[model samples]
Target: MNRILVIGGTGTVGRQVVSRLAATGARVRAMARNPGAARLPPQVEVVRGDLTLPETLDGCLDGIDAVFLVWTAPATAVAPALERITKHARRIVFLSAPLKTPHPLFQQPNPLRAMVEHIERLIETSGLQWTFLRPGMFAANALNWWAPQIRAGDVMRWPYLAAPTTPIDERDIAAVAVRALYEDGHDGAGYVLTGPQSLGQFEQVSAIGRVIGRSLRIEEISPDEAQRELLRIGPLVAVNMLLNAWAAAIGQPAHVTSTVAAITGAPAKTFLDWATDNAAEFRA
Candidate 1:
């Protein structure tokens, strides 16, 4: 059995990865700051770890063959963490940000960009195999942002109701990550994964409505209103980051890619498909 370590294993994508890997009988370890709260399967070894301190990973890397690395913080310590992993692991699947763009968010002045670039450089020269999975907006994010409103009523009020996106399913993203971690073909590859089609936020809300047998009304609000409402309910930093990203995508279409289908041997899931799959999460 191959031993794999998943960082950020308590997150939306990481939870799915750990679940899928455990179901398939892989020897998996989930590393996070709060391992006891991760709720991983009994088969998985949950270890307390932090990205900021790579030395804490020493005992956890014993016999670890591969890693699925996801950054939860500003990524200031990624290089050190990679150094620790490269010492033991043969392959690494890194969850990449859309910071591949040239905007200020991805520029040299950005701490996240610097961290991502540093890790990429280190992995490229480490003589170890690497794959980078860069996924667009997650369909799961809709649940986090809009599910409460959908559950409360049949009306969804949000900004960018017409903003288009190829919202990839986090489960599909994890599936590809697992393949890259365990398989042989993805070495030195960076995949831009997206959903099967570009759908606007309104369309996505409507899809969820259709899945749950309701007709939902989408009311588009001003960006200022959205920001104010978000700050009141959402995590301050994350909400601000998303507001910035949406501002950047005001007119430009979100990039849609074939990489998910190409790597997974199946068309990327539609938002409707995803909504149907997670219908229970949207119930009133």
Candidate 2:
């Protein structure tokens, strides 16, 4: 693919993909609702596009050979948005979850999962080459769940401390995505990506504290209390889905995979490595 477009370019993983592709001297374009404030690499073009508004995608997909799609729009927009994408781009790399994995953590039914399944079905039948990157718990999620508490105090309170997850770094996810977008032999691939090892929520928090040079205490709270506190930052659906998944994940080792290292030819980053790199985000 000579030229590529990245939807959701301003997002955490999307920005990493944009930066990596631009550094490789690939012709890259990023789609944002507000292109003026996208703040991506200056060498790449930033265009205004919205998945919900299908008409806005035409200009973004113009003359593009492939796309990196990080979809967060409503379910109502899935069909329409893909319709526009198929008209221009022949290949797409979708940021998806491990829907088919036998692990109980991902087997739970949720609104988000249902929508992703629908999107996948549509893409599979649309006659376009597609690659799905199904990543597990993201290491960046720690910044959302514990950053404020760690920045303010020494004690972080959370439930399901024993529940484990293989937290993949966003950089690794983006690296594989870039390869899928540009390289051959990746079409029809469904990669279940994860970190090198499993770590519990408490262990992840402690890792962050270690990186920031603090001996932070982790307090276990009840599920109800945790839900209330978390709802302040996330929607009810997402919050409940996480609580249910974590509760189901107890007493089970998380599912880890070597797909990231296999695809990128480098060892998958550990949770400690992610914490060390993002240590400043947790500092006061």
Candidate 3:
């Protein structure tokens, strides 16, 4: 693809995708509601657009050969947005969750998954060459959910400490996505991406502690307590979905995949690596 548009380009994975694509000298445009604050690479064209407003996307897709779509809003506008996208872009690479993956981690029925399934169906019939990057739990979530606790004390209190997950690095996810956007033979593909190894929540916490030179403790709490805490911080439906998924994944290791290595020609990064890279977030 010669020219690419990155929806949600200001986001974690989308920013990295923009950087990678721009590095290769592709004409890149990042669609954001506030282009002034997107702070993308100087070479990346930041366009004012909102996915919730389908009419705003009309000009954003112009002259774009491919699109790196990271759906951030609800699915209400997906059909209209896809209609606009297919009109201009020849290909699309979506950052999506592993909805069809049979692992317990993904098997749970959740509103997020339902929305993703609906979007996937629309993309399938949109006639644009498409690729779905179905990533598992993101390692970056540690910063959002646990950084405050780790920065404050030695004890990491959480629920379902035994739940195993292969947390893929956002950078790795972006690397694979860049390939799918510009490379051939990736259309009509759904790639399940994960980190190199399956690590329990306790183990992941320990990994962070090791990087920061602290011996942290994991205090498992009741699911109800966890639910109450999550309710205070996030939506109830999402909180419950996570609680149920973790409960189901207590003994089951997350499904690991070689797709990242297959596409990027490098082994998937480890949790230790992710912790070390983001060690400052966990430092006391």
Candidate 4:
């Protein structure tokens, strides 16, 4: 029995990964600062650990064969955490963005991309088997960015209405991660995951509208206004990166890949599918 450790097991994709791994009857352990708050499967052994504090990772890695790592913190702790992981785990499957892809969507250099690239370099030289899962925009962003406005009324205001993206479902991303964690031949491979079709931000909202039985309208706003609103909610660097990526992606089709089906033996879910599944979020 292989002991698998999942960092950020309580998060979006990480939670699904933990569930999938547990369903396979694998010995799964989840590391979180607050293990008590993590609503994981009864079989999973929840352990208290913080990635920022390298000393807390000491016992968590003890007997783990492979790790599903989701870097949820700053880049400052990445090096030390990687050092600890390399010393223990034989393999690691990392959840990262598609920074190396030449598509306009990923071409914009950001702090997150820089941090991931640095971690990738460290993992490469660590002599450990590593698989990188680089996924594009998440379909769940609709819930975060537009759900509030959708629930309040039939009109949603946002920037980059023409900016296209293949919003990959978090479940699909998790399935691929699970395969890379347990299977062979994925070592040193970087997988670029995306949704099945390219849809613009307006089309995305329309999909949500159809799912919720509403005639929704999208009002495009200025990028500068979007930046200011985003800055109020998130860091300036992340907001700028998003603004730049959307600006670059305008009038261009999003980069779609068959890597999900190639690896997981299933087609990637479309944005409409995601919208339909999460329709309740858009409903009052």
- How many angstroms is residue 102 displaced in model 3 relative to the true structure, after the best TM-score fit? 1.2
- TM-score of each predicted structure versus truth: 0.88, 0.99, 0.97, 0.97
For residues 15-130, could you state the per-residue lDDT of candidate 3 as single tens digits? 98999888888889999999999999898899999888998998999888999999969778888888899999889999989988888878899888888899899889888899
Candidate 1: tens digits of C-alpha lDDT, residues 25-91: 9999999888778888899999988878888987778789998988766566767877899999998
The reply for model 3, stretches above 4 Å from the true place, is: none
Q: On residues 1-284, what C-alpha lDDT tens digit does candidate 2 reach at each position?
A: 37999998899899999999999999999999999899998999999999999999999999999999999889999999999999999999999999999998898999999999999999999899999999999999988989999999998999999999999999999999999998999999999999999899989988888889999999999999988988866998999899999999999899999999899999999999999998889999
* Clash count, one per candidate: 0, 0, 0, 0
Better of 3 and 4 by lDDT: 4
Candidate 1 local distance difference test against the native: 0.82
Lowest lDDT sum, 10 consecutive residues, model 4, at 227-236
Report lDDT (CA) for all predictions. Answer: 0.82, 0.94, 0.90, 0.90
**Clashing residue pairs, backbone N/CA/C < 3 A, model 2:** none
RMSD over all Cα atoms, model 1: 2.8
RMSD of each: 2.8, 0.8, 1.2, 1.1
lDDT of 4 by residue, 32-130 (tens): 999999999999999999999999997999999999999969899999999999999999999988988998889987788888899899998999999
Query: So what's the TM-score on candidate 3?
Result: 0.97
